[model samples]
Target: MLRHFLTLLVLPGLVVNSSSSRSSSEEEKEHDDGSREKESNGHHSNGHGVPWGYKDQTAWTFNFTDCSGKSQSPIDINTRRAIYDPTLPPISLEGYDLTDDSALTLWNNGHTLELILPNTMRIVTGFDHEFLAAQLHFHWGTPEVPGSEHTIDNVHFPAEIHVVHYNSKYANISEAASQSDGLVVLGGFIQIGLHENENYEKILAVITDVSIEESNTEIPGFNVRHLLPNKLDRFYRYNGSLTTPPCYQTVNWTIFNDTITVSRKQLKALENTLKAGQEEHLNKNFRAPQLLYGRHVLASFMASSTIKNPGLGRMGERNQSTEQSEGLSRGDILAIAFGVLFGVSLLCFLLYTYQQHRKYTSITKDPRQNVIYKPAMKAEA
Candidate 1:
C-alpha cells in the first residue's frame, strides 16, 4: 500500500527520506517564530525564509502545499502537452557577451539570472523582443535527492533550474508575470550522473561564498549565457503560473525535454549549502503539490497544435513533421498497455483471495454439519 501511494504521489528521481532529523516540535517553533518576525517586520514570509520587501517583494515559501490558489503551481512538465509557438521569440547567442563583472554582480547580489535575453535575439524570423537578463536561483534538497518544485509526468529530476527573464519591455518581474508576454522562464532539469559539467562547476565554485543564510550576495562578472544548452530546438511549452507564491499565473514556461548532466560532486556542493543547522541534519526544502485547477494543458508537436491559428507558415510545416515522428514511436503506448495489464491482474488477484477467505470463514463456523451417504444402497435395491 505504501509503495502504491508513493508511486502515485512522488516523482521518480526523488529520494525519499524515512526520518528527518529535526523534531516536529522544534520545526513548529521555528515556523511560529518566523511568522511572528514577518508580521512584526511588516513583511510577509513566503515560507522559504525569504523576507518580504526583499528583491521586489518576492517571498519564498519552502513547502509546496502552502502555495495553493496562487497562479503558479509546480507543474509536471512531462505530463504537459508540447505545442509549437512560432511566436516564440528566437533565442540566439550572437552579440551577447558574458563578463567576469556580470558574474561578480550576480554573486554579490545573491541574485541569479533566470533568463538572459538580449535585444539582438529574435523570437521569430523577423519579430524581436528585448529582454533583460535576470538571476537564477535553485530550490533543492540535501545529499540524498534533488530539490525541484515542479515535477515532470509526476516524476522529479535530480534538480530543476529556473532561468527567469523579464521583458525589459515590461516594468518589473511581478508586472511582467502579469502579462502574457511579460515573463519567459526556461526550465532545465538536471540528473545525477558520472558526467562532468564544466559550466556547472564554474557556478558551484562561487556558490559557497554567497550561500550565507538569508543573506543575498551578488557574484560580480557572472554572465547568464554560459548556462544554456547548445540545442534549444525541442522543448515543452505551456502557459502556466509560477511555481511559487503569490503564484502569478502569467508565466510562459518552456521546459526542455533533454536533461543536463551535473556531477555528483557538484550536486553535493549545492546540498552542502542548503544543509540545516547541525551538520547531521538534511535540508528538506521542498514544497508540497498544489491543486490542479480546471485548466487544460495543451501540447504541440505531439498530436495537434494548441496555439490557435499560429501566424507563421513554417511553424505549421514543422508541426506536421514532429507529429509524424512522435506517431512512429510506439514505446510510450506499449508501456501504458503493460502498466494497465499489471494493475488489472493485481486487482483480480486481491478479489479472488478475499472471496476464498470469506468462504473458509463460513465453513469454519458450521463445522459440525455432516451428512450420511444412503444413495448407493437405494440404487442397489
Candidate 2:
C-alpha cells in the first residue's frame, strides 16, 4: 500500500516533464460544409484582376471557377492526419545563392512585397518535372494578428514565406499555370527567433524603397535558400490551388514542416513596413484557410502521431518563453532531460523512505521479530 502511494506521487512528477498538447480552438470548430465548389475562372462578379482583399473571401467563389475548386490551397494541415509518402525525395535547389553583382527587382504589387528572381534559379530536383524559380513573396499580419496563409493543425503562425516556381517545360509562367502540375510553391512558416536574421534583413532593409502600390525597386542580391528551413527532407506536400484568385488549381504545394525564425523586431517591421493603398498598411493580406474537401495531405517524412502547438499563445501570438521556437533548440531538450532525471531521483528517495517507515513500524510493534536479544544468563558465576 505504501509502495502504491509512492508510485502515485512519482507519476505526477514524470508527467510534469511531458510537453503540452495543443488545444483545439474555435478554428477547429469550423468544418467543411461543402460550400467550397468550382468556379469558371471568376470573371463575372469581381472581374479578372479587378481587385480583392482578405476582408472578403465569400465573394471569390462567385467570380472564379477554380477559386471554389475542391483542392484549394492554404488548407489547415492536420499533422496527425497527414499521410506519409516514403518515396518522396528531399527538395533540392539549384543556383539559389545570388551574388550582389546585379540587383534584383523588388515589386510592391498592391497586395504584398515581391522579389523577382532570375530563372536560372530552379527546383531542379524533387518532383517528376523540373521547376524554375520565378519570384518569392510573403503574406503577413499585424503584431496583434498572425497572417500566415497556411496553418498547421488549425494553429496560425506570425507569417509565411512562399517561393513560387513554374514548370520548366512551359515557355512562360502563364502557360504552366493552366496545367495540372504547372506550378510548385515552397512555403515555410515564420516564428520569432533568439536574434535577428541577416539573410532576412537583406529584404527588410530595403522595404521602404517601394512602400506604395505599383512601385518597384532594386535590392542587393543574397542567398535566397537561407530564407527556408534547413531541413528540406521534412515537408508536407499536396495538390492545391493558389490562395489568391483567379484561383488556379494547378499547384504542387510543399509546405516545410520545420519553420524558420526571425527576431521579434524584424517581425514587427514586416507587418508595418509595406503599404497596399495610399495610406493603408499592407497587413492581413492572406486569405483564410480553405476546406480540404477530402484531398490527401502527404508528408515527405514520417509525421508524429501527436500534434503540439508550442511557441504560439492565445490568438496565435508568440509566448515569451517559447518565442524562439525553431524546432526545439538544444537547451529545450536538455531541460526536459534534467527534469526527468530529477523526477526519477525524487521517486527513488520516496521509495526508500517508504521501506524505512515499514521497517520501523514492524520493529516498534513486535521488537522480537527484528531485534535479536543477547541472553543475560550469568552462568559463568
Candidate 3:
C-alpha cells in the first residue's frame, strides 16, 4: 500500500515539495512557448530579456522570484538517499523515430544551443499525462570543470541534455508553463567516449552556423531517440524547476540513471562551439546544486544496483543506407560471452567422454575382434 502511494509521488508534474504554489500573477508570467522559434536578431540587455548569467546565478533571485524557491533544480542526487519506487515505469517516448528531424530548427539561444523539437515527439508515458516535446538544450563544462546540471553521487559528467515538455492537457507549452502540474523535463547525462557519436551529427555538424546568439540553422534529423540514454527504465525523478533563469518551479524532473556518450572531439565542439551574446565562449553553462529543501528524489529502478547504461553512442557511425538497429547492451554482451564460453566447455567435455567410451568399448570387446584380425594377418604373411 505504501509502494502504491509512493508511486504517485514519483509521477511527473506531481510534487509536494513546493512550500507555497506560485500566485496568479506569477503563474501567468510569460515565457517561451516550448517549441516556438526565437527571433534571430533578438539580443538580451533589453527590457524583454534577463541579463542574468552563470557567473551570478544567485542574482537571478532578484529578478525571478522562483529561482529562490525551495524546489529549485539541478540538485546533486544522492542515489543512496533516493526512494526506490518499484512501481515507477519506463519513460515512454513517442514519435522520436523521425525519418527527418533535419528540417527542424537548431538555435543558439545565447546561453545554450536549443533544438526545437516537434510536438509529434511526445512522451507517451511515465508522466501523469502526455507531455509534448518543447525544446532540448545542452549544458556543458570546459576541460577544467564538469558541467552536468544534475550530478549523480556528486560526480559531474562532461555535459547534459534537457528535453523540455509540457502537458498535453494545455493548448500549448506556454499555457502549460503556468500550471504546477504542467512541465516535465527529461535529463540525460553526457559522457566522453572513444568514438564520435553520429547521432549528434545532425546538430553538431551545424554548430558553426549558429555560433552566435539568437542564430539558428535547419538541422537534418537522425533518430532523436539516440540522443538519450539507452536505458529509459532507470531514472531519478524529482520535483524541480528550470535550471536557467526565471527558473520555473513547474517542472517535474526525470534524470536518467544512464548516460549517453560522445567522442572527445564532439564534446569539445559542444563546449567551445557557441558564443555568449558578448561573443565570449560559452562553456560550463550548468547551474550549481540547489538546496533540496525537503524534496525527496525517487528512483524508477533499484538504487542499490548499478545501472549499465552504456548508451547507443558507442555503436559508432553507420551508413545512411543501413538500417538502424538496437545495439547490444553491456549485459547482453556479457551474457553472450558467457554462453559462448559455456558452449565451448560443454563441447569439449562431450568429445572427451565420447572418446573415452570408444576406447573402453574397444578394450572390452577385444577378444572376439582380435581372434579374427590374427587370422587375416597370418594369411598376408
Candidate 4:
C-alpha cells in the first residue's frame, strides 16, 4: 500500500512540472513576438505600424486616405506661408479652465506641458504656421533610467510632451489627420532640473483627485497661452509621422531645441498619475524611436534666416552663408520662361491661320463649281 501511494504522488508531480514548463515556453514566445513587433521598422502583417488600416484599444486608427500629401506628422514641418489676419479674429482661451477632471490640465500639471495644447493660437509669418493644441500625453522608461522615449541615435530625455494640433481652417482633426498638411505637433522635451514651474505646481496640486481610467476634468477660465515658450522664434522643424500606434504618417513636427525645466516634484506627480491603479508599478510610457522615413529637417532662425538640409540626421552648425538656396534655381527659371515663350508663339501662329481661313471663306462662295478663283486683273501686269 505504501509503495502504491508514493508512485501516485510522483506521477502527479511529473504532470504538474511538464505543464508548467509548457506554459513558460508559451509565455516566452508571446514576449518574443511583442518585442519583434516593437522593433519592426513600422511594418506589420496587419499594417499595424505603417499608415494603413490598423486599430488599437485607444480610439485611434490608421487609414492613409484620411491623411494629406502635405499632412504634418510628428517630425515633419512643411513650410508654406500662412496668411494671418489680425483683424479677422483673435484666438481666445478665455473660457478655458483647468481642474483635476480636465485631462489636458492634468497632463500639464504633471510637467508634460507639451501635451495639453490650445485649440487655436498665434500664427508665424514666414513659417506659415499656426498653433492648435491637442491632448497631452507622456513617454517614459523603466526604473533604471526613469523617463522619456529612447531616440534612434540612442539619445534620451527625462520626458517629452506632444502637443498635437491640426489646421482647422482646412478640415477637422480627423479628416486633416491623414494628409501631409493634416496635422502639426509641437514637441517639448523636459529635463529634470532645479528650476520649478509655478504653472505646473497648480496642476500637480490636484493630481490626487483625478482617476486613472481615462477621466475628464473641468478647469474654468483656463488661458493656454501662458504655457507656451516665450521665445517662439527658435525651433527645429522636420517631416515625420505619429510616434504612437496607428502611427499615422501625416504630421509636421516642430521640436523646440530648448529643453523645458521641470522640478523633481513635477516629475513625481507625473509618475503618480501613471501609477493610478497598477499593482506591478508600470512606469514606462514611451514608444521606442521609429525609422527616420527618408525625410529632411529644416531650421529657421527667428532672429536670422532659414536653414534647410536633408533630414537624414541631426542638425549642424553651418553658418547662414554656407546654406544652399531653395526652390527654382536660375537655370530652372530660364527653362520655364523659354517654355512659356514657345507656347505663346505656337498660339499666335494658330490664331493667324484661323484669321486667314475666315477671310478666304468670306470671299470664296462656291454653290455648284468646286473650283478656286484667283484675281484676274493681276495677270495683265
* Poorest lDDT segment (10 consecutive residues) of candidate 3: 38-47
Write one digit per residue (lDDT tens) for candidate 4, span 120-216: 3433332344534434455554435655542312567777655555555543343344444545555667767797876656555665555343233
Best by TM-score: 3
The alpha-carbon deviation from the true structure for residue 53 of candidate 1, after best TM-score superposition, in angstroms, is 16
Per-candidate total of colliding backbone pairs? 58, 6, 4, 42
lDDT of 1 by residue, 1-381 (tens): 233222212221111111122100000001133432111001124333434322232234433223344335456553323344445444544323445444232221111211222233323221245554333555556565656656766777767776555566654333343355665666677778788787777667766664543333344433455555556655665555555433435556666666777888888776666323233322334454454453333333333323333543432333554445433235666888999999999999999999999999899888465655565555565
Question: Residues 218-322, candidate 3, lDDT per residue (tens digit)?
Answer: 766567899998889978877777676556576678889889999999998988889987669988888899998767677666533323222212212323322
- lDDT measured at residue 278 in model 2 versus the true structure, 0 to 100: 86
Per-candidate TM-score against the hidden true structure: 0.56, 0.68, 0.69, 0.50
Q: Which ten residues in a row are the worst by lDDT in model 1? A: 22-31
Candidate 2: clashing residue pairs, number:
6
Ranking by TM-score: 3, 2, 1, 4
Candidates in order have lDDT scores of 0.45, 0.67, 0.67, 0.41
- Model 2: weakest 10-residue lDDT segment is 22-31
Q: Which ten residues in a row have the lowest lDDT in candidate 4?
A: 22-31
Q: For model 2, what is the alpha-carbon lDDT of residue 160? A: 93
Clashes by residue pair, model 3? 101-221, 102-219, 102-220, 102-221
User: Candidate 3 has what TM-score?
Assistant: 0.69
- The RMSD (Cα, Å) of candidate 3 is 16.0
